[model samples]
Target: VESILDKENFTLEELLDEEEIIQECKALNKLVLLDAHYVLNSLMFSLRDRAQVEQLLRYIVEEPSEDDDSKRTFKFPFIACEIFTCEIDVILKTLIEDEEFMNLLFSFLEPNRSHSALLAGYFSKTHQEVLRQLVDLIGITSIMEVLVRLVGADDHVYPNFLDVMQWLADSNLLEMIVDKLNPSCPPEVHGNAAETLCAITRNAPSALATKLSSPSFVARIFGHALEDSHSKYGLVHSLSVCISLLDPKRSAIASPLMHYFRNQHMYEPPIPVNPETINAMLPKLGDLLMLLNVSSDEKILPTTYGELRPPLGKHRLKIVEFIAVLLRTGNEAAEKELVGSGTIQRVLDLFFEYPYNNALHHHVESIILSCLESKNDAILDHLLHKCDLIGRFLQTEKQPILSGDNNLPTLPAAGKHAPRAGNIGHITRISNKLVQLGSSNSCIQAYLQ
Candidate 1:
């Protein structure tokens, strides 16, 4: 029987016709559908007629049987049938849509507290694949209700049906999880539910956008994560990443995104990197900064690509427009504090120590130059080495601009043929104009000195 089943293209009718021979042959191969893993593996291994196999699986799955004895333990056969069958669509559609069958099926989800964990842990590609097919075939609203109910189980320690949502995205299922996982709920519930949704939507930005665009829903979701209730950094960070991915555009939505971040949190200042958490958390932070329009220097700085080009570097420039928005809003306090306390210096040090060969040193220098030019002295005050660093940066950066010199562009700086102004005000005005009008980057460096 096993040999026949193993053949590349055998048919189900062939197996059934030789039932007597199969029964006898079973002594050697030992039909293991009476047991679980063996049963699933057997089903996975078999490649007989799909329709007939599905029929056999349905019979095993749907047949009423007692559960107290090994002889009565029908779990293995049911699971095997689930694995071997390709038309799970017919099974799930009928099972999930039929109220009686769905209740019976859902009952199996818990499988009694004693056996639930071990049995649930038995979730294989077969079970998830079946669930996905079922979700697709069933009504979205109905499936969503079932999902919310399942997740709401206080005893529901592990995340199930997560892939269902992913499959839904693939099939254009409205990320219905967003609605079911209510944000107005308690903090723990909200966080767990949000994590579940994020797990589904992490790489699916359009689906993420679907959730965030719903104003009330998006606001409550983020508000709880940031937990205005208690300034937790991790939740705030997660919320930031979510908001970034959501790409909230409206003033109403974007306002809350920034306001919560700008609002000071009281959590114990960030802890030293736990190798496990750093990799997971850093990328999310980078994405969030991109959405929040927070400067790279202000929050997390770019780490990829070589440094020694523009002040911000190549990696940072791609997102420079977003960072510039932070300056326009005058929300640099957090950034200032971050830089003042050594974070900025550490980032710069890292860049110089690991320089890249093709680094464009001056364009980045131009950006930083532009940024410093627009800022008031107060913002610049916190940036230590403000003058000297600019000087060093200019020395490295000015070569290209100098090379492009056309009649030196008539620099505003005073030289051998310069005119003297009559009053202090005039001199100050001329000095200010010179700073702005210092044509070449090199000339600007000379004027600053």
Candidate 2:
């Protein structure tokens, strides 16, 4: 097969002849699905005219009817992809330089259109230089949405896709992505827009730092999405972006990005609480606990069989884990914000709610250690007094342990009983910290005794 394929390479004359095959296929209303790669490769370089390119693009975009025998006609885009991967420079120059071809190609992205992902995947695989030219012709936002869809829909990683993402960052296209994340846009659009922003920031942090250096730019992009009441998934995307920007490794923009997240609350009803909104908001520790304890109804609870699931269930645990990360920064401002936001109490509530959650226990322990390590009186006061930290710990520790000897159904060992061991260790450590903070306090003395 390799030898046959090697011998079958089309020469210029053979390519010219294959053009007649394209005409023959079209005249008979038949698709050359089987020989698409050969047909496209043969015709690609030879057909450089705008009219010719548009015709090829139309073949890719046009949908055959359900009743038609040529339903697989949409596979033309895959052939186009093969051609793109092989003769990218020649094909890209022809497509990017011609507005009609570019427009026709982009038309495949409309939501109602079939085979949009095929078109997008092919477009994402173009050369970086060609990608820049393509974006210039089709506009960055439109192209970004296409790329975002391609990335989100498939698990496969394409190097060309990463190159295009880097190009967008280098070209300063973050603002274009921000513009697409408005509340008026569809949820899918918002999701893709946010995903694109995240991809750029995650893959190319230096480029993101350049954008984040501008307060207005950060506010315009990340801040705007946060403040848009109707931006559901976009808000989640923005929060994820914030988490990336705030990484201590990328401290260049961390301080300013933290400031934006801390103060921006123009949208209401302030923090989001319900499952749908929680899934959308992608809350961090400060955001999670503050919003959770706002009202009794909004509090986080343990997962129960037959109960309606909270949107942030497992994701919530991940957010709680971030508390330790924020504290690790020793960003005094962030620590103060967490203490002031009533998050410590909420953290305790979450710990108690999911007693089997060993991961949550570890995170709460980190928060306790950080506070003890900081010796910040404000944090101490909130934990000890306002949040009644010791009392709750004592109450949880005193709760009766269920056992099989009573002939009662034991709470499943893998689920409900998993954290009981961790709970004892957590209580002992907190008691030790309280003793060190002040043996003089009656509550501390009593808990220790």
**TM-score, each model?**
0.28, 0.46
Model 1 residue runs over 4 Å out of place are 1-80, 88-106, 109-126, 132-196, 199-275, 281-449
Q: Pairs clashing in candidate 2?
A: none
Error of 1 at 389 (Å): 16
lDDT of 2 by residue, 1-449 (tens): 12222454533223223324344323222333525555444344345555555655665566656774432444454444444444334555677655456446545544555655655555555433344443333334555545543332222333234433344455535555566666566666665565555554444334344454344555555444446533445555554455444442332243433433442342212111122222222333343444343223333233442111232344345355555555644555556777777666677776665455566676687667666555356765666677777777777677634222212111324344422323666677667767775665554455345
Q: Could you give candidate 1's per-residue lDDT for residues 1-449 as a string of tens digits?
A: 55665677775444444434333333323434435444334433342334544544433434334554442244444344433234423334544444444333334333232332333333333345545553342235455344333332222322333333333334322233343233344444434444444433333333333443344444444434433423333344335334343322212233333432442242212212222222232323333333322233322232232122123332333233222222333333534533444433433332232233112222222223333453444434433254344443344343312121222211222233322211222223334544664564443545466
State how far residue 73 of model 2 sits from its true place (Å).
40
* TM-score, structure 2 vs. true: 0.46
As a whole number from 0 to 100, the lDDT of residue 62 in candidate 1 is 42
The most accurate candidate by lDDT is 2
Number of clashing pairs per prediction, in order: 8, 0
Candidate 1: 10-residue stretch with minimal lDDT? 401-410
